[model samples]
Target: MVRAGLMRIARLRVTLAYGAMLLVVTSALATLDPLARERIVEKASTNLHNLAHGHFGTLLGSAFVVDAGAIAVWLPNLLCLLALAELLWGSTRLVVAFMVGHVGATLLVAAGLIAAVKEGWTSTDITRATDVGVSYGAMAVLGAMTAALPRRWQALWIGWWIGVGAAVVATGGDFTDAGHGLALVLGALVATRFGAPEPWTRWRLGMLAVASWFGFAMVVSTTAALVPATSCGLLCALVGGLASRLSALRTRPTPSATDMVPDFERHALS
Candidate 1:
């Protein structure tokens, strides 16, 4: 799995790296004027109202544009997670999973938000929210990558994602969080058809670490009187460390059976 991820990174170095480079440049340009930047973000946003008008350019373009603060964070996530999915499921299938998650979650969340607006649950207009970022795609890739990992790693990886995501949303529920949660679920569902997980060979220390962190976060969220921000930060740190350690582990690359069709004629001839 590690070698395969590395190979995918090599294959995507030019595409994703240059794309990240361009995002940095665009982000700098957007920062020059506060109003202009706001307008750009607004237009690039995939809004509930905007979707009704058949505006899909935002779906693809938003992936390329992000706030200056988030550009630093998302660039690495996009490269690492997407590359891993690309290697495991092939670039075409990975792209499909990403788009499926992106569009599906966006539409689903938009519908929910529109319903909220109609029901007067939120005074904030759904049409004006700055909902622009690569988060949807990133979550999708992470979800799909979970299916490609060994079961031990899969449980931990997927668990941390769900736990942290649910904790954050439970504390600060928002449209973006809803979109992220939906994307993860959608990605996992679609990816099952494209790839299978590796068998578990032993106890998964990673799973324990993730479960402990998740339990801590849940306990903090419910039992403690700590500020939400502080608790979330500590939880994020724990999960981030676990993810980094997982990234650094060396795992033997196994061939994906589902990704390749068997050659019956060649086998017969042999």
Candidate 2:
């Protein structure tokens, strides 16, 4: 019994390992004075300047580091999400999907930021903006999970995320949002290797309209950090609701063809 219990726990070794690492990093951060901690976080950021200087450590370190005060929120949320991804994709696939989203999204966002700076669409100071956390990859994994959702839900979920991310960029919301959108795309793309969910239903045309408009509102309202932190915490809470719905439905038997018809479509026909 003991061995069996331990074996089951070991299945989530990746999530556990990550959570442990975060605690260690947070403890060390807490030891420092406020100013010093802030400075260290700034230095540890994988911002454009740090990347330009080729300080690879910052790139790796940023993913594990979070402000001491924020860990309470960060720890639980990430552990839940990461564990879900690990369970679905296995340890190796989860890690690969995450790192790819993190690194790829960071680079893509940075490139876009550089162009914006050059074009004078934004400030140079934005380049020095603090960029850290597991969200980029987390969002990717979240995006990748679209495959597990119902057919119509798969369309709306992915569409809403992409719309929000794109609106953030188009409206100059934040570099973070740009990265988020890209990570979602990257994750979804990679997940296609595992076989995609059913394609979008014709009803998706209506869902696209609903998702795009509301997704814009979700982005503009929070516009700060649409991930799972700081200003984006509200957005994260909404995503939390979505996740709960996803969990409830993940194991549900496929809906009948008639049952799958969206309410709006049925109402329209009526």
Candidate that scores best on TM-score: 2
lDDT score for candidate 1 against the true structure: 0.64
lDDT score, candidate 2: 0.71
Expressed as tens digits, the lDDT of each residue in 70-95 for candidate 1 is 55554554554555555456667767
TM-score of 1: 0.65
For model 2, residues 100-177, the per-residue Cα lDDT tens digits are: 888889889888888998999988898789988777877777777776566556655665565556546655557777
lDDT at 86, model 2: 69
Residue pairs whose backbone atoms clash in candidate 2: none
TM-score of each: 0.65, 0.70
